[model samples]
Target: MPAADWRASRLVPRRAAVSRAQVETVAGRALGAFGLVFGAQTVPTAVDQARFMADGSGVAMMAVVYGAIAALAAATFTRVAVRAAALAFAAIYVIALLAWPFLVVDAAGMAGRTPWLYYLCTVATTAAVIALPVAPAAAYTSAVPAIYGVVRLSPSGGGASALIAVLDTMYAVILGIVVLVIITMLRQAAIAVDAAQEAALERYDAVARRHATEIERVKVDALVHDSVLTTLLSAAASRTPAERALAARMAADAVRRLDEAAVEVPGLDDRVALTVLTRRLRGGVAGFSAPFIVRVDGTDGVELPVEAIDALSSAAMQAMVNSVQHADGPIGRVRRELEVRGVGAGGCVIRVIDNGSGFDPAAVPPSRLGLRVSIEERMVNEGGSARVESVPGEGTTVTLAWPAGVEGSGE
Candidate 1:
């Protein structure tokens, strides 16, 4: 299957993968909203019982309870102090329940119906679940409902029978326990998902680093085969003074290449100026057996890592060498140009173009390491990229870019 089709099929599964933090935020907000709705429903009952409450006690109770609920609602959206607000509401509700008899006008007058505070029993238990840890929340859930049951049986609490009080207490306890279990299960599942995701990412990073190390090894092996072994063979075959002199030059070049490779460690922090890189390229072009028209621009004041400088320099040189060896034709008919330009912050682009004999890039065999290992793989290992554009009998353009996408700066 194509990548687009596979992604389309995975859309629903990807959307279902919610993070732990997101689950907690949504649960907190939902509980806060529920608290607001439950608080609003108790307003009518509170007003009806106002005459039974003592002189400033009713107003004080309403202010504190309503204020805590409002703060919880605000905390849901702000994602700050949510536990504090829930704890305040739970504590204040329990205090008001305990002070009900003391604040009442007549204890015997409330012998008919339930107390106004009866409606908020479940709300208090739910708030406790949100505010406290599992063990404490379970304890609070049992204790608050039992307290309400005792209050319901008292004369000031409407003189309810034993059966009604027990039923009410059991209902609140069951609901609070159910909500606690559900929220706890959701949190555990989310935490497990987060851990799995973290582990997968760590494994992927380790694999990528290993792959990069393997590519670097292959590039170094190709360099040994192309430079050192070939130079040794040439020196062994030397039969005259001129041949020996040429062999000696090749041996010196091979030693220099090996020395450079020895110091090229991965993740090196050394830096060099853009001018230094351009100067090196210019000196290399001057030393090449075939001439090249070099053009440089925007190469002032930029600095790059030593690894990047080395990769770009080596790949650009290989591109030029390929042009000299394979693209050369008769006399001055072949025109070769090398362009280097500084691009996005601490980035650069280099291009080697040759109007010599061109061949199809697709026709190149895998046995040839000049374009693959020496140029393409080398740049990729350094966090850069290389592109070769060619057509039979026309021309070839090898464009190398550092830090990727910086080639757009030329446009």
Candidate 2:
């Protein structure tokens, strides 16, 4: 890669790393508030005590400015950025002292009393900022030094300020804790919502399955009654060679038409029982379809919400029709291995394996009407998926994963 291109690529990874670190820091800070408060407070104290602040007013003013900058950084903060900014404040405090050597502190004279009002206001502001439910950690960082003073320093006629400082420090801690609680609750709520969404998708797939089955049954019944039997009877009755030949041809055409017409269904929800589904499907096929060797595995006692059940079932029916139409090479084709297994609490997989010419799934975007209506959309709606794998002149496998999670429909 060119120099500029390589530079950009390197920067991208660095930025991503930085972003991830920030997120981790934020999560850690929330869980470890006491540690964060203690660690953050040490910075300002170290700065104030450093030789750079011996000139007093100049260093104090610089600290004030740095504190404001820290507050801004905290207000619009990311996890890593805020921590860096906090340390940056400490670094700035030091740099300001070092860059302007004239303002160096004189320890003996540096013990002058800071205004009581200054500590009170700064501490209160820090508490209020950090107390905001979503406020970042840096908001209250400036108060760390004041908090340290209340607990550490005690005095004579200059002592009332320390008492107020102690109160302020307690408020800051309480405020930070409150924010942490709020964030934790919000996070839990988000997780619940995600679970709910997954559940909804499964239910959707189940419903689709039920409806598809009902429609296919009606079509099968119609085709067998109106077309299949009528043609076969005519073929039998024909006396002449040409009459029998035409009758045989008509019978074949009717059978083909019947298979394609069988996509309609009666309405059903996602909660239909699997045993009931298999029975119903077998009945619809009657004697026209091949005998199915259904070996249900792993469904010891697992079940899913009604909607999810419906979705997977619908996808299964669609896959079956596809097998009948596309998998069979000529007649009496042996497309075996139809299995449904429950995956977990609220998940299952429907797989149909067929020995026939398998087309490139990528080259074909599911041109079959059943594929669009019953498989792809149905699986996705359930937060699951459908995969079709096949090689030319080889077999095809259709797998539909129902999803995982319980919803309002939980048993």
Candidate 3:
């Protein structure tokens, strides 16, 4: 909307707003002080008889006109315009010296000769200019006239000049210290503003990244639900009774794994412990051979990334479903033993042994899609491999092994 509002919005806190205003005030004072110094030099040079003032009368008329103009500009204009008016006043003062230098140069007789009404007007105007936004600088420059008047009115040239010199020098020294302090404060304010702006930008960037990541997660989940989930449902619906038994078992296993995975946030993996896994499997693949031996034995304290655990769990569930459903004989004819053996290299082996009507794995066909996802693909994703061994009418066994904390490739 407005420039002021833009500054206010960025301020963020009330203290900052107040500090910024104070800084602006001080900067204007600095500008005004410089303006007064310029005027001090200009006034002396313009009136010197050594210069264009070879004729004195010309200076007075010029000074009078300049004074009137400077007064008007200073009084009517804003704080910024007061600077130009100060120099204008200096110009007018020099010109006035040609006719009325008595006002500035003579301290004792000024009130005696000047009309009372005119004197009041001069005082009011001078006070207003001196107190303008750059009052500090104006006060610094005013030291010149104060010193001149003290020297001019002194009974002894030595005492008065010495007193004026010392007082004026002290005033300048104090003024310089104050100006340097103000400059230091301004520099600090600039640095603070930069830091605040940088923090705001960083916060904005982080929020944007979080939002983008959430959107990507939703997209991936939607793809899984649409393609993989739909195929499982369709296959289950169209099977014969004997086939339907197997399909239902597979469907149940797939749904459980999907449900577990869905709970994980998009960037995290959803695996849990392997012991927790076998307990879950016994419920699904009912004909699993009894007393499965899972020997992490004493190495059971190992923890894994949730994602790797999730993939292994799903893979085991898929392999068991294959053993239970794909057999040519009844469920009672199936024999199975599932074991988890921990390895020394921060890895684990999942072995599924079964006695059932077995077929040549290669001739039986490319691995089923769920087996591809849960076994072969899952094992590879988890930094190991999967193998299926079978001899017809003898038995079948599938072993999937994986590294415990395989890092993602960032592909």
TM-score for all models, in order of appearance: 0.61, 0.34, 0.30
Please give the CA lDDT of all the candidate structures: 0.77, 0.50, 0.48
lDDT of 3 at 312: 61
lDDT of 2 at 10: 10
By TM-score, the better pick of 1 and 3 is 1
Instruction: Tell me which of candidates 1 and 2 scores higher on lDDT.
Output: 1
- How do these models rank on lDDT, best leading? 1, 2, 3
Q: What is the C-alpha RMSD of each candidate to the true structure, in Å?
A: 20.5, 20.2, 31.0
Candidates sorted on TM-score, descending: 1, 2, 3
Q: What digit string (tens of lDDT, one per residue) describes model 1 on residues 191-255?
A: 77656654543454345446656866887898899999999999999999999999999999999
Clash totals, every prediction: 0, 27, 4
Q: Positional deviation of 2 in candidate 1, in angstroms?
A: 37
Best by lDDT: 1
Best by TM-score: 1
Superposed model 2: Cα runs more than 4 Å off: 1-53, 56-152, 155-165, 198-222, 229-250, 258-411
Model 3 lDDT-worst window of ten: 6-15
Off by over 4 Å in 3: 1-273, 282-299, 404-411
